[model samples]
Target chain A: MTMKLWYWPEIQGRGEFIRLALEAAGIAYEDCARVSGADALIADLDARKGRAPFAPPYLDIDGFTIAQVADILLYLGDRHDLAPSRIADRYWVHQLQLTIADLVAEVHNVHHPVAVMDYYDDQKPEAARAARQFREERLPKFLDYFEQAAECNDGPWMIDHRWTYADTSLFQLIEGLRYAFPRRMATLTPDYPALARIHGLVADLPGIRQYLASNRRIAFNEQGIFRHYPELDDE
Target chain B: MTMKLWYWPEIQGRGEFIRLALEAAGIAYEDCARVSGADALIADLDARKGRAPFAPPYLDIDGFTIAQVADILLYLGDRHDLAPSRIADRYWVHQLQLTIADLVAEVHNVHHPVAVMDYYDDQKPEAARAARQFREERLPKFLDYFEQAAECNDGPWMIDHRWTYADTSLFQLIEGLRYAFPRRMATLTPDYPALARIHGLVADLPGIRQYLASNRRIAFNEQGIFRHYPELDDE
Candidate 1:
């Protein structure tokens, strides 16, 4: 049976990470919210009785539902061969994915530092301060860690020679950061050659290439986690 | 072989969640940072060659190391019977743990709204704003979701009658929140009867009671993730 993914239809947000993985694995699934309106998505989520997802980007597969971007990736990794076969390696890949999730959350926070419910216009000054710290410290620290992971492996993949879900997610992270802080990423991107190489490699993958060209991939905008406000970017 | 847990020596932070699970399962492991020094912990983390952890609260078992609190708990859950036997149930439990992790991160962010590297005092204004939003919206939303999970189950546990790592982690989450925001928690506690019930049940567990009475359990302090700042709390 075809799996169903429920998320906000307009923005990629966390759901894009899952979309990338399914596309990479050439798996068949329906983007439920995209097909049905977001009201339907909310109703479906509200209707879930037990073990309900806390937020969107939940997948309903074979009668069971899973949520949390990293957890969903972990479930997908096991089934789609998107992770290493060895148990230790699988955990390591998952650890990397969890770290990526942390980075994504921080990226969202840069624009919404004081209050998630508040608008960026209300938090712009705080966002500016947050963006500076993120660009200087947190972003570099995370990039360095990912680059180290790539360097430890045999090739551009997170694991030895084989690309895992972590790598695809990493590609999305780099893409998001670059879009959000083009000047900052431009200055720092050269320092992390391994990450740059992995990003390029993931972009060239046939599945990712196809997905990127398709209309199914939503363009990053102010509404999504990674927004370009120009002022949030630094040189 | 005895497992080794590495985290910041002083604060409960993320490490406490893993500690609670291990304690609940009656597993004996070394709190490596407490035995050694923080310097040693940093040296150990820095010295690892490949597949190194992004941050602390990593567990070294047998030969491999697992990082990320949820991931570490997932590993321990499988070996120590800390989670359900069924694969679907295991994933559901893990999903709950991940949500708890998200809440923990948000709690930390409430104090460090602008920059994590900066002192909380530096971001006091921003933190005040964050704390208001957290208490007004995020905290209630999270509590409501977790309470629903507990209510849906056979008992106070997140899953059926048998308590899992998720239950232990939720217990800690509630405890930390109370310690951090007593006034806010006092007003909100009655609204989440299931969570309060689970907290009471977990505290009564022999292993947890022993751990709490022992020197192993660190007292809640300002340095920890759940800092009890009077200004941050509201009635």
Candidate 2:
């Protein structure tokens, strides 16, 4: 039997990163929240007791559970041959994944600068200010680093021309940023040719192409992490 | 030869977490930024063109450079036997380290809520609100989870009786929070006795005790991740 993954049913949010990886690898697993209801998701999480994850997108397999997208990818990468076999290379890819995680957190913060629990309406002013910094400073900074990384490698992938979890994640980052800040990404696209190439390469992958076209992949919305706020986007 | 660790010279920021783990394990390494200068640190980092770290607190050892605190520690934890030997236990430890990383990022945001590049003075009102949420909700929530984790374990450490990098990180979290928000921590301290016990155990570790007493351990200040601001604290 395939393992069970638990996350919020509505938005792609952080869970989409995991979904992309699983789909890209053609791995089998059940998204519990989609099959069951959100209440079941909460109840299942609450029942974990002492070892509960701080948030969702956690995977339960063969009686062991793992959370943190990078950690999950780290485990899955090694098991399914998604990452390099060498220790140094593995750590390098994991480091990149952690950087992606940082970028994701900052993306979420742009919408909820004052408080995560607070709604966008309540924190619109702070969000506007944060969004400015993110679009003007952080977005370019993160993309430039990744573009340089991809260029340094011999091929479109992040490491040694191979499709590591980082490559899939970079694709998601680009896609999510485009969804959330279409105008800004359009303006900035010319500067990140390497990232653009990698994104294209990942999009062409058979599994990803199928998954993206299918209903299993959720749409981006205000409820998600990378929300498309028109006020938040700028050239 | 010992590894070379690069970070800011003046403050105990993210680098201190790595420093604490290495110190707790009695691992020898040169604090490159302290010996050389902030300029030298910048030059060294800038020179790693292809895969440079997004920011500081990176480690260069045996010709391999690793960034991200948790990744560096994950690499070190296995070689130095600071983490568990089993694969499952190792991933578990890494997951905890990732969670600690999340908490560390949130702690930094409390002081610079509106912008990372902006001074606290410019975002005082926003910082005040962010700090309140952090101190009242986030700090307790994170500490509570870790406290329950500690209680579930057989000993004072995060996993089975042996000390791991997670234990060292928990120590840094507690110490940093106390320094950054003394009054807030004092009020909330009674609720997390397991974490307190883990902190005490880590403090008493002979190697850590020696390192703490030595001049090598940098003190907390305004420049670091955990900064003291009277306005951001509440009883």
Candidate 3:
């Protein structure tokens, strides 16, 4: 049976990460929320037996469910033959993924600076200040860091020419940043040539192209993490 | 030979979490920065090659160093027999640890809403708004989560009265919160009695007592992750 994945159906949020990777790899899994409702997702979590994922974006393999975006992807990477074979390379793969997770947290904080529970509307006053700092300082700083990592590789992707979970994650980061901070990303897009090159290259992969075009991938919107607020953008 | 730990010399910062656990476990390790200097800490990290720790507070073991606070603690937890032996129990250890990592990031952000690179004085205006929301909403919400987890066990520690790294990290979290927002924590402290219980209990541990009294443990000063700004604290 295909694995059952549960999260909010309406928005991609963190769950989309699992969705995108699963779809890209052509792995069989059910996005439980989309099939049923958020209630089903809750029931699934409540029904988990031992050491289940703390929250959604979890993968239920056989009967075990795992959480943490990087951990989940690493699990899938190993299962579906996405990760490198060597132990050291796998460790580096996870390290790169953790860096991606770091950027994801920062992206969310652009609008919800102090608390995640509060709406961007509630935090709008703070978001303006955060957005300015993010666009001017954060986006470039993070991009530069990733760009350096990419340069560490002999070619494209985080580790050599072959794609790893980190590459897909970096691709997601690029797409999300472009969506959230288009004006700012536009200004710095050409600067991160390696990242820009990988951005274009990942789309050429058969699985990624299918995933991007399919309805499985939710379009970027205000409800999601990388919501583009024009006022928060600058050249 | 004792393991060599590298981190900033002056501040407890992230290093204290590891330091406390090691000290509490009666494990011996040398503080690399104190014996050497601040430059040595930087030099150690600079000299580390290939997908090493992103920054300081890394431990040098068998010629290999790893970073990330949670990862580092987990490393010591396994080696020092601090973590659970069972895989399932250990997963819970990591899950709770990851959650604590979230709170740590939030604690740091109370003062660095704009950027950590910028001075707190420069970001004080931004920090005020961030700290207000943090104290009013985030702190209690996060503490409530930890309190619930603490209640999962029968006793004071996170898991079955065992003095795991989670307990030590929780101690630091509580201490940091108090230092950062004394008046706010004073008003809110009563609500998280479980966490406070755990806090007081961990402090009384023999190793913790010795470490606290000894110069080995760094003090809570303004330069660390937790800093008290009177203007940002209120009932």
TM match of model 1 to true structure: 0.98
Q: Clashing residue pairs in candidate 3, if any?
A: none
**DockQ numbers for every candidate?**
0.89, 0.78, 0.31
Clash totals, every prediction: 0, 0, 0
Candidate 3 error regions (>4 Å): A39-55, A60-65, A74-82, A121-125, A154-156, A160-162, B43-49, B78-80, B154-156, B190-193
lDDT for each candidate structure:
0.91, 0.89, 0.79
iRMSD value for model 1: 0.7
Name the best candidate (by DockQ): 1
Better of 1 and 3 by lDDT: 1
**Per-residue C-alpha lDDT of model 2 across residues B147-219, encoded as one tens digit per residue:** 8878878776899788999999999999998988999999989988888888999999999999999999888
Per-residue C-alpha lDDT of model 2 across residues A1-235, encoded as one tens digit per residue:
6989999999898888899899999999999999998999999988897666888989999889999899899999889888978888898899999999999999999988878777989888999999999999999999988888788887668997678899999999999999999999999999998899889999999999999899998888889988998998988
Positional deviation of residue A141's Cα in model 2 after best superposition, in angstroms = 0.9
Worst 10 residues of 3 chain A by lDDT: A48-57
Predicted structure 1: clash tally = 0
- Could you list the chain B TM-scores for each candidate? 0.98, 0.97, 0.96
Docking quality tier of candidate 2? medium
TM-score of 2: 0.99
